[model samples]
Target: MSKRPYLIERYPPSDRFNHWFVAITFILVALSGLALFHPAFFFLSHLLGGGPWTRILHPFIGVVMFVAFLALALRFWGHNFLTGNDRQWLRQMDDVVTNQEEKLPAVGRYNAGQKLFFWTMVISILLLLITGILIWQPYFAPYVPIVLIRVAVLVHALSAFVAITGLIIHIYAAIWVKGSVGAMTRGTVTEAWTRQHHLDWYRKIKKGEIRGHDHY
Candidate 1:
């Protein structure tokens, strides 16, 4: 009988669920935020309901996105720390883009690009949360000074642009990397996929150094 390829669990069901939850909420929040951001995007408000409704729902949805992201961040916090290997991997960006895995360091579960993007999301979301509150109106903005609110508005818009840009790159990378989306959607990846993309992680898994199922 022919032997089947080995498979490895990448994300548990709970983590996958958490990640998808955040993704969904982020989409909603982004659309609603854009609607309130400019007249050009005002048409997007129809997605939530209308202008008045979009204004009301945007901040609430943003709160949900921030809280959900915090949960996801805490879960993956340990994996994202920058290391010497990661820095080296980053320095060899040309090799990475050219599929020269053998020329680069054996990457861990997350690569340098991923770690940097993770931190970008963290900082951007924190800024969005703080600034969103400052300009929230009725409940909070009324008590805040106008000058501070003005500053908060500019910061919030800039933060949102950063976050949206990061997310676009993140999505593109996921698509660029074969089998990456499958790791999250199916909660597993083939042994070959792991070995090629995250060789250090694969070695750790083989030695029982990391958590995950490895079986045929």
Candidate 2:
């Protein structure tokens, strides 16, 4: 009989749910935000309701996304800190793009690029939240000076642009790397997949240093 393939848990159900929840809310917030950003994209407001309703719901959706993302960030932050190996990984960006992972240092649970992206999201979200409140209408903005509100609006737009751009790259990378999306969607990864992309993590599991839900 052929031996059953080994599988290792990557994300638990809670993590998966948190990730998808943040993702869905992010899409809603981004669409509604863009609608309010410029007339050219105003048609996107229809996704929420109409122009007035979109304005009303956009900030609320943003708050929900922020809260969900905070949970995800806290859960994964430990895995994403930069290390000596991660620095080396960043230095070998050419090899990364060339699919020459074998030529690089042993990768851990999260890679250098992934770590950078994680921090970028963290910073962007914080900036958006703070600046968003400063410019928020009918509540907080009234108490703030007009000049500060103007500055906040500018910063908010720039931060949102950076965040949206980063998200596009994140999504593209997920699609580019085979089995990555499965790790989030199915909550597990094949041993072969883990060994290839995150050999250090694979080794830890094999040595029983790192425990994961197992299937065979």
Model 2: per-residue lDDT, tens digit, 98-167? 9998999999998999999999999999999999988888889999999999999999999899999999
TM-score for each model: 0.97, 0.98
Q: Which stretches of candidate 1 lie over 4 Å from their true place?
A: 214-216
Q: In candidate 1, what are the lDDT values of residues 1-216, reduced to their tens digit?
A: 989878899998999999999999888989899988989999999999999999998899889889889999999999999999999999999999998989999999999999999999999999999999999977899999999999999999999999999999999999999999999998899988999999999999989887777676
Residues forming the 10-long window of minimal summed lDDT in candidate 2: 207-216
How far off is residue 169 in model 2, in Å?
Answer: 0.6
> Which pairs clash inside model 1?
none
Check candidate 2 and list the clashing pairs.
none
Give the Cα lDDT of each candidate. Answer: 0.93, 0.93
Native-vs-model 1 lDDT? 0.93
